[model samples]
Target: MAPACQGVAVAEALSIGVNYGQIANNLPSPARVSWLLRSMRISKVKLYDADPNVLRAFLGTGVEFVVGIGNEAVPSMTSPAAAQAWLQQHVVPHLLSGARISCVTVGNEVFKGNDTALQAAVLPAMVSVHRALSALGLQGRVNVTTAHSLDIMGPSFPPSSGAFHPAALGHLRPFLAFLSATRSPFLINCYPYFAYKEDPARVPLEYVLFQPNAGVADPRTGLRYDNMLYAQVDAVYAAIQALGYTDVEVKVSETGWPSRGDPDEPGATPEYAGTYIRNLLQRIEMKQGTPLRPATPVDVYVFALFNENLKPGPASERNYGLFYPDGTPVYNVGLHGYLPPMLVSNAARQ
Candidate 1:
């Protein structure tokens, strides 16, 4: 049977979803923010956490949500009781109130670092959460999974020859089996911009930016790809297939280009960011699947909603937002949202 999540064909032109990260101090409240997303007709969202205020605001709005369980909470989630309590506190109330939640990511990129404990707890947390959802009669309705960084892929070149790092395979094998058994998607954070930035000389600027360019060929699959994003996605599919789990689905949890960067950061500009998103939106709207999975449309949640001023690291780390805190478009790709004008406008005015 086809995955239930893939059965619904989101109206491509108007169905673009954005990741709503709240790491910054200046983001608009969830209530006003609801108006902004509704105005753009965005019916899907992915949150880094199950924020109560955000959940309450989007209640009855018909926007489907993909909430998260932070890495710090992974250890707690390993226990079925703690997982149940967390659901009761963070998820159950919202679902009862008519929030359309579809997936719950257990942790974000737990395998990318040296946190052995977080990595070990990842799958168990997912299992406990899945069991809790089942006990509550919500398993079929909500998926349990985790997102991983592209760094987990050992070699992502040639699209079809993708393979997971040998080190990650030890942990990933059991994780994939869990997803296969439960029918949840395997989320990966794939960013082609990193390749271009790391090796600008070899990586074509036009290709990474989604500009017109002669594409590369995957010798094994004999498929030609015009864009790096598709190639990266296909590579992931290849990697997954190599693991003997062809039925498992792969989804992109984060992918975007920065609009600004430090002096040394090349290809980080408003023009490239706009171009990349516009082209990406166009492709996703076409319901275009990767070369490897031609029958399945790519599932994605764009990197971020707003520039996170408090985010550490390089300048580019904070500029991935499509909008500013004041509900202004950072660089237009014809999609913008406004936080609610008043905190209780929806509850009070409506």
Candidate 2:
């Protein structure tokens, strides 16, 4: 068993979040990870799965978490009994022990492909999960929703005219309604790095990296956007509003740049990745809001915590992490986190 997280000073409060993924085998134990995160003062974390060791490690430290329901598990969750049973086992024990889990994503990027069965099951699974949460008396405590890939948007440029792809509109309309009714934010994974990597000749590195650039104007609202991240966020707001739901708030579920990549993958370097994250963190720290939604600050979760060596894809896919597996920063962004020596952590557990 892993040791209880100890010997770390309490973290100072910071609103920035990071995605904690564990697709690799060499990552440190969750107890040690909890220490690393607290030292950096990152107060929110989103995980691709509800790893009990992780939730258990953070108990009572006051870090907020957004847990996931993997794609394969979504279909089974359509059964109210199954959803209830899953939650009873995975969530209840942790919350009872004071883990601050705030959201449950039923599936990820569900409409990104043409799998009719998966598409059909996503919403029902979410519905069943919501019902189960209410049955467990946790509906008001935790939000229920899913993350979406930005491909669901059509012509995702020029924020004002943004609309959903005809193929995704049918699914998105009802999905947006559920969010509106439940008072949950619409989560979209926005990656400007993707744009620049695909066409570095056309996509300006300055604009995509949140560096100084000639801002673009949305003709309809006359809103000016200096950075691609804000533009992509407003584009999602436009898409949601077009469906006749203005109350649903839009939040970025994932966004990051890679520190390394294959030869063909352009703009994937530590310099670009560090600059992007540092700038974004600065904006988030200042509570900066998008031009369209000037009053409400954009809520974002940076893509990942550590670069998982085993992640399958281009090298960039495995490189979207702020830190390496040893809990060292991939590139320094002034966040001085600490990881105990392996022997120290193991001895503490023993």
Candidate 3:
């Protein structure tokens, strides 16, 4: 019933990472959150940025982190000096301080939209960051990569025949080459809830929720897929392989369900959200892999650690957390842990 998305006693070391997003004001301090995660046995966390406070709080906790460079910072990262300086200012000190930072994402979902300039800068920025890492003698030790949105794919159905959008190909081709040469993972944010909300009538709720159904098969590979999450992963693998790079590993940088939403957002209730997460947690516990690659279990980071009240999107966007800002769970999904209240300093305690 434990569901912190972290692995334990598995030979493959297969673990699930949780996105420790901090876009809310009422959440507990990073120190207390660290206690909560370790209590639940989660050792991997992904952050939207390299916040020094969070990094410092988790010092010596042994939780591996995958930090990021926001879209606004991508163009600047294209410069080698800027990349190195940024890393030194944000990442290096933490590493020296015993923070286990395992990866640096240059930019996030650059190809998901039509920002020509930002899209143009992503690969160069990645290259520059990677070069800076190598210069610092930490190339393979800390990978350089980016998280992508599933919208980058042109046709993700059927798994085996997936391909990147033609326009995206111009950028992805070289990006894949960089990832291959540098040995970094291709990260993607896959959300099955969007698919169900878009067409709940046709997209059976059980399938998206990971319940037992007839499941579909890829016409080419004839692989049966009972859930949309695995199919989305294999489709990404197909896309990467189509680009002629079979060696690059694809990781789900973000995936989760919203426990609450606006009236129009169908199937966004707490019950469905709990089901989606619970089922996914079960699969991670079993070390389940996609039908296409049984040997390589799908690496995932559940969308968030807590619901961010200030997130600027649909209600669903702000409500994707497994827990709320007050450190209380929004919905029960088999996993349970305690989030201690804020610690009092000597002056405050007195």
lDDT for 16 in candidate 3 is 75
Counting only residues 3 or more apart in sequence or on different chains, how many pairs clash (N, Cα, C under 3 Å) in candidate 2?
Answer: 0
Better of 1 and 3 by lDDT: 3
Residues 72-108 of candidate 3: C-alpha lDDT, one tens digit per residue:
9999998999999999999899999999999999888
Give the total clashing residue pairs for model 3.
0
The residue-by-residue lDDT of candidate 1 on 278-333, one tens digit each, is 88888888888887787888888898888999999889999999889988998989
Candidate 2 stretches with Cα past 4 Å from truth are 1-11, 346-350
TM-score of 2: 0.96
Highest TM-score among the candidates is held by which one? 2
State the displacement of the C-alpha of residue 59, model 2, in Å, after optimal TM-score superposition: 1.0
Error of 1 at 206 (Å): 1.5
lDDT of 1: 0.86
Q: Report how far residue 193 has shifted in candidate 2, in Å.
A: 0.5
lDDT of 3: 0.87
lDDT of 2 by residue, 1-350 (tens): 22333333345566689899999889999878877887788879999889998998788778899999999999999999999999998899999998888999998998888788999998899889999999999988999999999989997779988889999888888888899888888999999999998999999888988899888888888888899999999988888888899999998999999999999999999999999999999999889999989899999999989998899999999999898888879998888888878776667555
Candidate closest to the true structure, highest lDDT: 2
Cα RMSD of predicted structure 2: 2.5
